[model samples]
Target: MKVISDLEIAQTLHLPNECEELQLLMMKYECAMTEMITKLEVLSSEMSLKFQRNPFESIRCRLKSPQSIYDKLCSHGYEVSYQSIRDNLNDIAGVRVVCSFIDDIYLLASTLKMQDDLLVIQEKDYIIQPKNNGYRSLHLIVMVPIFLMKEKEYMKVEVQFRTIAMDFWASLDHQLKYKRADIADADAISEEMKISAELVSQLDNHMLQIRERIDAGEK
Candidate 1:
């Protein structure tokens, strides 16, 4: 058995906890989140092999707690409380998966949801029901079990599946919007962003059609 040193764990967490109870709690959460990410990565790789699809271009998993949540709340002039973070984490146990095409995004999401051990807490088919901002992807909140030496705990994992094209546009939009928030041409840039979003949507549909044709020929 490989043992992770306490020092290594401490380095990863970065936050100092005065109470032993809090330290243990933080360690447990970190370990559980890391294990969940590893499981997801394995699933992603297996899926790529099974479908002969390109490996996921990128996948990210994150775990946030009440303190971190409270900081954000305070920054936004909201109540600074532990419960707020807990509530937010309950809603956003996130994983972002980037794929080669729109169809692959759906197919990968479906494959992951089919795993018997993974319990789907909720699902939002954003690709089919995109937000008004033109965000396109599948979002699923799932519960995965983590086994410790003598116990098992359930952890929430959020999965967001998207295509490379969608990611590219989103990345650019995020950078420009945030980096140039005070620019005089921001309104003009926003309009162009909306147009680009629509183009990505059209491209997604066209790619999906091509994939359907390929599947039909395989049948």
Candidate 2:
């Protein structure tokens, strides 16, 4: 069994007042994530009706648990406080949109950016330049407005856009890398995954081209 590290221990030692503050801040992030998901659902519906196809296949969301947040802050050499968490981490709340095709990833991301309420803070195109471990996705850090009972607040949420193939590769890669420790040729496996990512990229592009041609009524 893995033992808890010192960072985890420190994060668990937050004061009572700090805990209350952190709870409220986490609630705000949760609300922000919900609003973003709802916005995407609305967009998905509208796009499906207008274009006769949905761009995204599924939407997945996650909010970092309090313990995870605290551990992250401690790992970054910061005190376990709400201020530190807000300043240090951008992925406390995250949403992932899985699409059927490569073009859908970019199209959905562009559509989300066009919304007046969502303020795009940062964008990273990992699909174009995949990570060494075969990771491929587009990441966006956006600020979304959440209207409370008496106040409107904006909170940051990290959004990721990925194709079905990309998500499949990522899921397997994550499991293989983290779930196993007895693999002998880890480096070789990493290299193979990179090559597989290239193949997946080619497949995505080919399918996208075929889709475009079909939409254009071409044989």
Candidate 3:
């Protein structure tokens, strides 16, 4: 018989009383995210060599913290049950892929979707149609199989594909969102950021056209 850890029991019981349990479960989620990241790394490396061009600039992974999970559940008006956490939260594990060019973002996303083992649960193309706040990225919710010693577990992860300029814009915008501010000043800042996003979008398109012309001349 296998002895289950406190965290394993907590997962089954759906009680958030024990801090250690939440910590252990989050660690396991982190491990799952790590496995997915490694898979993406291999795919990116092989594709770069085959195409003679690197499609991705960088890959990053993160596991949401226990506090964040709890807050999210509360925000959605759900009870803080372990099952609710699993069922309601689709982004417990997240991966961010930054690309050198705008075209590279779509290319990488299509390649990932073609993988047999990964299942695309949902997709939001914020690139083609930017959000009201001027946010843009290709977001994919995918389920990946992770094999363990005893059995295999399928985990849901949010994968975001974006150009370097898009990533930079998002990073700055995230900082602005977290800061406390007056209403009038915040509206002005948001409008300025929207203008910045438009400029960045134009730059991405211009760079893509230049790269395409260069490739065309070589061929």
Q: Give each model a TM-score.
A: 0.73, 0.89, 0.87
Which of the numbered candidates is closest to the native, going by highest lDDT? 2
Off by over 4 Å in 1: 1-25, 63-68, 75-84, 91-93, 211-219
**TM-score: model 3 vs. ground truth:** 0.87
**Runs off by more than 4 Å, candidate 3:** 1-24
lDDT of 1: 0.67
Write candidate 1's Cα lDDT for 26-126 as tens digits: 45555655665686688777876887766478877665543454456666665433234334454334568887777677667777678787788889887
By TM-score, rank the candidates, best first: 2, 3, 1
lDDT for model 2, on a 0 to 1 scale?
A: 0.84
Point to the candidate with the largest TM-score.
2
In order, candidate lDDTs are 0.67, 0.84, 0.81
Candidate 1, residue 29: the lDDT equals 52
Checking candidate 2 for backbone clashes, the offending pairs are none
Could you give the candidate ranking by lDDT, starting with the highest?
2, 3, 1
- In model 2, the runs with Cα more than 4 Å from the true position are 1-13, 179-182
